[model samples]
Target: MAFTQQEIKTGFKAIFSNFGFVLLWLGQLTSQLADRIFVYVLMIVVYQSTHSNLGVSLPLLAFGIPSVLVAPWAGVLVDRFNRKGILITADIIRGLLILLIVPIISKSLLWIFLVSLLIYTAAQFFAPAETSSIPELVEKHNLIIANSLFMITWMASSIFGLGLGAPIVNFFAEKKTLAISAFLYFVSAGAIFLIPLKPQEPAKKKTHVLKDFLMGFEFVRRNQVVRYALLKLFVAASAIAALSLLAISYASQILGIGEKNFGYLIIVVGAGMLLGMLTLEKLRHYFKMSSMVIMSFLLSGAVLIGLAHTGDLRVALFLIFLLGVGNIYITSTIQTILQRKIPRPIRGRVFGVQNMLVNSAFTLPVLFFGFLADLGGILFSISILGWLVLLTGFAGIFLPKFRTV
Candidate 1:
């Protein structure tokens, strides 16, 4: 049903009417913010101690690899078990695992890496469960705003977490800062506990768990539109991974700003995304979702190349802001399309496959680009990466299957 003007007038008020979804947003936001803080801490610590560009990139690989390996198993659990229980349990596991870092990190860096792997694995389970739970918490008509709000939580939290991460680390240092990171996970669990949600049972099945696990992968491949959405998201995700790996170096080496100043870049991007999302909601009905996706992909590619080439901080900031604007359109729309198109029975697995595709896309590129930046310098490495994104955008136009998006 098309939204009434009153429904539009309600805007956020309509979303807030669904209290369960609000709790879910709260849980996801804190957990995501905690994730950023953890990354920032690792970034600062590794950069300071080892002073290696690749060293700063290593934590990203550690974060993404676990999610890739465990995503299928996690998706199966999300579909088979109670998602609320899975979310809560994952939070507890990650919270406790992060605390262990405070002790062992002083002894060895291996411990820090290991803890990051374990905590991310726990999050892998939480990710699909949360994505799959959206239909249960909010009505179908509200999915766009619901997904947009979720994306906002993502950028907004990162803005604050990354913006504050350096100062917080400089203030409390690593050990105490990690202690606080653990506490945020507890807060997430508490918020999730307050969410009065029940898991939806898929159509009755006597199928084997392995068969069920494999089905999510097969499901995505069979659907043309969903597959196209995933391919585009994968491309965008890879570019983001490359950007994240290079941001510190981009600031420090190319722009002649200090490394810590990267946070300002993140904050600007977040602000741009916030504006993009707001614009999207207002104009959602003005364009077809498929057309919008294609346009945004092309837009992202153009600006990413711009950001890569610019050395002036002011120009770089504008380009990153435009990237942020384009990114929200792709993310929010792709997620909303996935939610609307995928059947709830298999939503967990679809999202599981999605998590694997994006992060797997995220993992290898971050490492490759880090090595590339070291060898070729940040300017050449990023310029190549941006052109790659632009190429992906071109692919969407020529590929007839993408026309179906």
Candidate 2:
């Protein structure tokens, strides 16, 4: 359903008045900030010690591998257990894990990878619980605004966290940086503790773990809304991942800028994301959620195609900014739809599936596009991706299931 102007105004008021959502948002903000900082610090510590790119890649593998292997089961656990308790415990465990890294920083790379693995494994559980909590905390009408706020904070944290990481590490050093990240996790735990979620009733009949895991995939297979939403999210994620790999080449060849200056383009994209979040409610007044998603896909595809042909830095920056706006529209709209449509009992499991697809997008799409860039040239690869996205958007217009959402 599309939101009216009055509903949009009321949604903003609803979000701020709801204290439970405020606390959830706070917890999310702090936890995400800590996560970004932890990653930055990990890269620095690993590079300083081993002075090898492979050493850095190993830690990233530790982070990404859990989403593939452990996330589905983690969702099962989230469904069976008390979500609030799960969230708090996950934060505390991750906090302690960050602290554990300090004493082992100088020991061995193997030990560091082990700790990183544990930390991110805990994160797999934290993620599904956190996403599943939102529908519980806010009115259905407010879901769009609430998600906008969350995504806004997420982008802000990425920009500020990475931007500040170097200076923070330079001043405080690596050990102190770890301490600060740990403290933020504790703060997140504290915020989550204040949210007034009622206890989950115990399941009357326990299902087998394998059955429960398969149930999530089965539901997605049968539910067209969820299936398509996830597909759009995967495509969006893949586009972002491919762009991340290609941004360096785009900067160097197309814009005549050095590779290091690619960050400026990213910052512009972040700014556009912030703009998109702030303006999303107004946009919703004019378009259905499905229309927004379709338009965003088309927008992103067109921007990429434009970038492939453009030589002017200003025009490239504008296109990249538009891509960021399209990205937020696609993600935030579909997330709200999932929250509204999915039954509460199975919410975590579906979102766990989502996490798996999104993380997989980062790895597989990056690898494929990196190869494509090498073999076919950066512009050629980008044009191919753009055509795929554009065609998908056009296909969505003709498909009945895509619009039913």
Candidate 3:
């Protein structure tokens, strides 16, 4: 039977009406919340024990490094294995790893650190499975809705989890907080169980390691639109990382706020994200992905530049919200565009490459920007990066393909 446009829309609506989507979303929400809580708690534990910023950042690097290193391989596996089974196994392993840390709470920090690293590595596997699984389960027209829902839950959970973690930790013992996080992981695993979908078949022809690894890169290279979209993504993600880390410092020093007040900044960003995601479907019809991306970059840069000069906390909060809105719109749109362009077979690898590039871009700014902050004040460093973002955005306008989109 031939498919009609009306059938496509109705089919999506039917999918949303089911109990499975509800359960899956609940599981996603719980897992994301737990992920944020664990990170915040880890930072707290490290800072409390070592009293060193560098020491606290160690766990983050450990987690991020593995994910970046293994993303391509993981992506290939996602395409090769049962995506549902992979996620289920990953969540279970990660949960068990978190639980393992409970006993070592009173032990040396190294032990807990090691367990956290293992849990993060497990998560790297789960991430590609989860990303690739969504497209298989939902209708093509509903991809945007699914992705936006994921992002909404993600941003909200991140803000609230960080906001609540410290207070909960303060009220309860460290071991108890860790236990709570462990439970959340199990809950997330249960949620993965609710997603009703099978995995993709392994590639028909046996492939070599190098060829499999380059799958995502080659796909993007072949698709002109996808390549530009990814480059734009890389640029935007790097600028975001630089600004976000600086905002943490901005809260502590420039705004003279306590650690808890950082939650307010997060909330502002989350609120903006929620708004952007909710309206994105309508926006997508009017504004092309490239247009939205360029506008977001330009506006986000301008906001950062304004923020660099601002001394008032309220104003900084406002700019952050604006930044959040622009960021969400751009990111969600690009993801949707990519989802449409890339076939299901290679989506995992392409997304994995996108993830790797983004992380690589984000990593570079931190190294140099962190040093710049030490030499110059945080404000000046932020201002410099903001200017660079503005330049990139302006240069984007000159690119024929991006402008046409």
Candidate 4:
């Protein structure tokens, strides 16, 4: 039988009216690709120079800590300033900071790391602005689709960037590679300028910025659902980071692949994430939020555990693929839930707090996992975390709110 005309019309409407979404997705693709490339480039460069996991991991630490420390203030600005302007300014600042490397790469490692630190701090402001701007660009009913598109680009960019980074960095000098990343940031800044919508004006009251920042904390404290959602996200982000910290070891030893293969392995995971995000809307119609959330966690937790048991490279790749899908769905759904639950005026702050949780969740585990990998081997350490993730999900299943959601 032919599909109904109403179904076709609804699909067409969704595509035609979502011009902002198209721009957002394209911008996200380019920016995230550059961002991921920067991460891998830093890691590879540091490892080649210092040959220590700590050296490769230092930039991640540098990036994460400032976001955690400055999130409250960053939240306030995200709310008070024009978010689109914040986004554009952040891109320009970060691009300029990265370009500082072109002339200084040979000076000292400390100088390069400091530039990375500045870029990370800039990211603190950029994240909240970008995340909070999404709901304003699309219809309420399109939140799932919008989130799906965002998640898809996020994973694709990571996989693509990392996959491309190894070859590019191998071919180009370090300074030249950094220059490519800078070019990408300039392109992203240009896109932000083209966004047609304007940011909201600041409130008329001349409130202190610190006091205004505290209001975000107070507002989140009063919202139970947002708090619960953030907690779940914390657990998920931590587990994912723990898993990622072990990937280099896993690639080198378990998979019989070299450093370059880690990038390719991540691409497999990204493929799974893209598939999951694209299908999320359809899945939501069949499963309630509660079911999807629980299943997402369970699947991710299970895959990580299974990844440990497999010695076969193909089996391991499949497990990682499943983990990617599970993680993206869980994380994207949480963001969509926040967009629905929080008021727009405070959305920036809410998301800023959420960003803090994400940074904290991912960062806190790095040292512990790095040490664990040093002591117990990467597989065992990651296996232990996989179990914790599973237990956390099971416990959440019994929460009254978890069931209701």
Candidate 5:
């Protein structure tokens, strides 16, 4: 299973040489940067508007619920349609939705939430399409590096975008910030057009797509390793979701830091993520997937427990950095493993199921934690999520069956 230096070099050469992948990277960079900016900006605005952490989380609830609800349908569309077309169409619609919110955000918070929800609904389609298209864009052996880069830029964008949010918001002021967000999506659409990717799907039978859809679930049910990896991934997703929602209040209320200062906390987390991926890129050939999987979950949980108790800003930031490291390790490993294991025809649907569960992990927990944080206070709620993560890690270790996974 180990890769040679030559193999790694060739993989890097293969992806970089492909013009289509270069375009895909540009599309991801702009769109994801905008994604971080828009989501965090909107959350901050909502918090400022209502002065309620629950209200802050409501928008995310809106974003996540629709994505989860529509994931299955979106998967079907991704498998059936031209992935490039879906990417273009999604970008256009998401941009328009961001544009529509510009003027109304100052006047109506409700309008902001509604428009954002629709924007994210469109984004769910774009995600699976892009993921499923990757196998077609590069050689099979290069997928680890491909998935690794995908995860890295995603974090790098978040680092730059989140760290830059205050400056961007202050410079553009709120009105132009919305415009900038919309502009990025449109630019992303144009970039996507440059990619020549075409995902090969199964021939249509008059029978029904629901059968094909059910088959994705059947595949999951039958494959023990995928099932284990996916469930482990789901646990990681849930912890991050809860932690992300908590960070806003943690920084603002407890840390006594303002928006800009709080974003730095997130920036540290992003930095850790970048480093984690870099470490993975260098060492992936040397480790078993189970080792990466188990260690990431354990490290994430341990860091969260420390982060929950530490009131010192410096200590909290350090823990957050480790948390980010653990987060990326879990995510990157899951994606690489899944991409390698799944067949191309049903890949979209399976990835779609992943979207559904992960978003559900996000939305439903935020819904509960928003209320919980509001009632019990932020630190207490965050500790619970931390413990839940730790418990999952321990369960993974004790479960003899997971060793095979």
Candidate 6:
């Protein structure tokens, strides 16, 4: 099952040399960077205006709600139409929506929420189309490297996007930052335009959307690998979402730094993710996918527990850094598994379901933990999350289906 060094070397070389993949990667880089900054900016604005963790969570809820409602239909469309068109159109619409936010920035939170809702609704279509496109653009054997490269840039953008958010807002002001994010979305659309993807053939027989969506769920139910991978993905997604909400409180209350400086902690987490991705790239041949995932769960839980008690800035940074490493390992491994295991024709539908689950994962954690942090304090809530993660990892060891992964 181990890949040869020559095979690995060739895979990496082939990824960069493939023009379609390069364009896709570039599109992903810009779009994801814009997304991170957009969310950070929204959180900052909402937090400052209302000064409540619950206020901050409201916008996050807006972001997640669309994924629940739109992703399934978006996935069906992806299978039935040209994905490149969907991707390009989504970018344009999202860009426009972001621009629309500028005029009403000073008006009302409800307007901002409405704009946020529309922006993420467009994003729902973009996400599955973008993921499914990777397999089409790259050779089957090179998928490992392709996904690795994508995950690497994903974190790199997070590092720069979140790291730059405070200064970007302070210097350019919120309106200008929104303008810059809109511009990046347009740049992403332009990159996708240059990619030479063949048109997806229409389904020979028109299928009902509800039927197709159900079929996707059926497939996941029957396929143990996909089911298990998705469960792991959900856990990882929830952990990250909850952490993002709590990081503001952790920075202000625990570390005694101002809430505006929360991005510094995120920057540290992103650095750790980048380091983890590089290490995973180097050592992938040495570990089983299941082993990597289980280990990551345990590592993430331990880090969270450590972070829960620490008040020293350096120690908290180090622990959160490890949390980032564990998060990346879980995500990257599960994503590669899904790409390899799912059938090509049904990839869009399944990934759409995945988007739903991941976003739904965001909804509960953000709301519950936002309230929990306010009531029980940040450390207590974080400790509860840490224990939950730890127990999940321990349970995985005895689950026959998971062990088989």
Tell me how candidate 3 scores on lDDT.
0.73
Clashes of 4: 1
Q: Please identify which of the two predictions, 1 or 4, would achieve the higher TM-score against the true structure.
A: 1
lDDT of 4 at 295: 86
lDDT of 6 by residue, 252-346 (tens): 88899888789888888888888887798666778888888888898999999999989999999989889889988888888878888999777
Clashes (backbone N, CA, C under 3 Å), per candidate, total: 0, 0, 0, 1, 0, 0
Residues 221-296 of candidate 1 have per-residue lDDT tens digits of 7898899888888888888788877888888888887887677788888888888977997667898887778788
Candidate 2 residues 1-405, lDDT tens each? 566779778898889899999998889889988987787677666656754333444555676678778888898888678999999999999999999999988777788888888999899988778877888899886887787677778778865575456667778988899899999999999999999998778889988989988887988999988998888888888887677557656776678875435546667887788788878978888888889999988998998888888889888888888987888888888888888888977766777788888777655566677677777888888998898788778878998877665
TM-scores, all models, native as reference:
0.90, 0.78, 0.85, 0.86, 0.91, 0.92
Worst ten in a row by lDDT for model 6: 396-405
Model 4 lDDT per residue over 1-405, tens place: 122558546744784477765666666777777787777777666666765555556667767788789876887777777888888888888889888866866666788788888888888887667767777787776665566556666767767797777678778866788889888888887887787766686678888887777776787799888888888888888886665566776787778887655777877877888788668867887887767888888888788888887779899888888887888788878877777889967766667778787888557677777777777877777788788778767866877766544
RMSD of 1: 2.6
Off by over 4 Å in 2: 2-20, 41-60, 100-114, 134-148, 155-160, 163-178, 196-198, 245-264, 284-291, 305-313, 336-345, 370-388, 394-405
Query: Which residue segments of model 3 deviate by more than 4 Å?
Result: 1-13, 47-56, 102-113, 139-144, 170-175, 194-204, 282-286, 399-405
Ranking by TM-score: 6, 5, 1, 4, 3, 2
Candidates' C-alpha lDDT: 0.81, 0.80, 0.73, 0.75, 0.80, 0.85
- The predictions' CA RMSDs to the true structure, in order, are 2.6, 4.2, 3.7, 3.6, 2.4, 2.3
Displacement of residue 147 (Cα, Å) in model 2 is 5.0
* lDDT for residue 262 in candidate 2, whole number 0-100: 52
Poorest 10 consecutive residues of model 4 by lDDT?
Answer: 1-10
Of 1 and 3, the candidate ahead on lDDT is 1
Model 6 alpha-carbon miss at residue 77, Å: 0.4
Which prediction has more favorable lDDT, 2 or 4?
2
Q: Which model scores highest in lDDT? A: 6
